[model samples]
Target: MLFYNDYPLPLLGWGKLRNRFLPDKGKIMTQAIFKATIIAAAAVFFAIFVAVVVPPLIAQPDVVGAFAAGFVNPYASGYSSDVLACWVILAAWIAYEAKALGIRHGWICALLGIIPGVAVGFALYLLLRMRQLKAG
Candidate 1:
């Protein structure tokens, strides 16, 4: 079986390296790095939610009705439907990658993230993937 052992790892890039190898002392460093990334991501998500998503929901006279119109109405549903599909694809991708890297709790974070928001799930996966992605 072919593995990605021969590939060069990027110092700052998380994607490929996180899934491939770990340096001898990678765990401690990865935790610190993941902690920083998670904090930044959480701040961004919260800021966007408070500034953007909240205003619209607050402005809506009938919150349930608004949701129904946006989610159930075919005319307005196309874009959201596509986005939902994308989230599913993202979830599947995260799960598959986590499995391949043997990252413990990665899938759990991803699944939980989906409940609150896909962004949350992504952040959780990123936070929990430090050990798998560490490289010397």
Candidate 2:
């Protein structure tokens, strides 16, 4: 007599298969949310630090003072324009990534891009996550 029965397998029997093929959606969402929150908080803290601490530190400027003066004074003429150019370039890169990859991947790229600085990093992360749908 045949040992096997009608249904392909019981749900219990399929556990291993399910585990291999599919991830736990809830867990993934939680992780993503946690990461986004941390990134946002860090950006806020960095902004505060720059505003409150940086100016006083600059006033004293030991070794760092010389460096800051050297850097800021030389480019004073068109600093704003240079800053705008850098931001535009960064925005374009983020847009390209968003178009090429899904939002999640785009976010990953943005987070990595944060090394350039906090504002750019936060902007990229926000832009990537602006659209909610996951990429196929």
Candidate 3:
């Protein structure tokens, strides 16, 4: 038997040492893909915000007016209403999960949900939730 850092090496095989030191490749790949999807969702939504909103925002610079415009028509009103409802749902879930899963900084996502919209906030919250669950 050999010794490493004052610890005796396994006599059977090196598989135990590799398993103890390295994580599963498949698991790592899956986790990376999952995190990338979440980040990509946020990035795509942010790009949409910049393209669809930034021009008018730069010209008018009226935050309240921009928000009120979301209800300018019946269709717009419906969409805006849905967005608000989703934000409420997201906030409620965040609050519940904070206690149940020990997720923190969820309030920031809730606030972002109202401003930049639900897609970004929902994605961010999912990322945070994944990280917390993985840690546990």
For each candidate, the alpha-carbon lDDT, in order, equals 0.65, 0.56, 0.87
Number of the candidate with higher TM-score, 2 or 3: 3
- Candidate 1 achieves a global lDDT of 0.65
Clashing pairs for predicted structure model 3, backbone only:
none
The Cα error of candidate 1 at residue 62, in Å, is 12
Off by over 4 Å in 3: 1-33
Q: Output the better candidate (1/3) by TM-score.
A: 3
Candidate 2 per-residue lDDT over residues 30-95, each given as its tens digit: 756866775777677677857866777678757555335535655663764564466566657667
What's model 2's lDDT at 90?
64
Which residue runs of candidate 2 sit more than 4 Å off their true CA positions?
Answer: 1-26, 31-39, 44-48, 51-53, 57-92, 95-116, 131-136
Ranking by TM-score: 3, 1, 2
Question: Model 1 over residues 1-102: C-alpha lDDT tens digits?
Answer: 232344455556567655655544444466567688777887788678668767777787675675566577676799767756767877777778756876
- Superposed on all Cα atoms, the candidates' RMSDs to the truth, in angstroms, are 10.4, 12.1, 11.0
- Model 1 earns a TM-score of 0.46
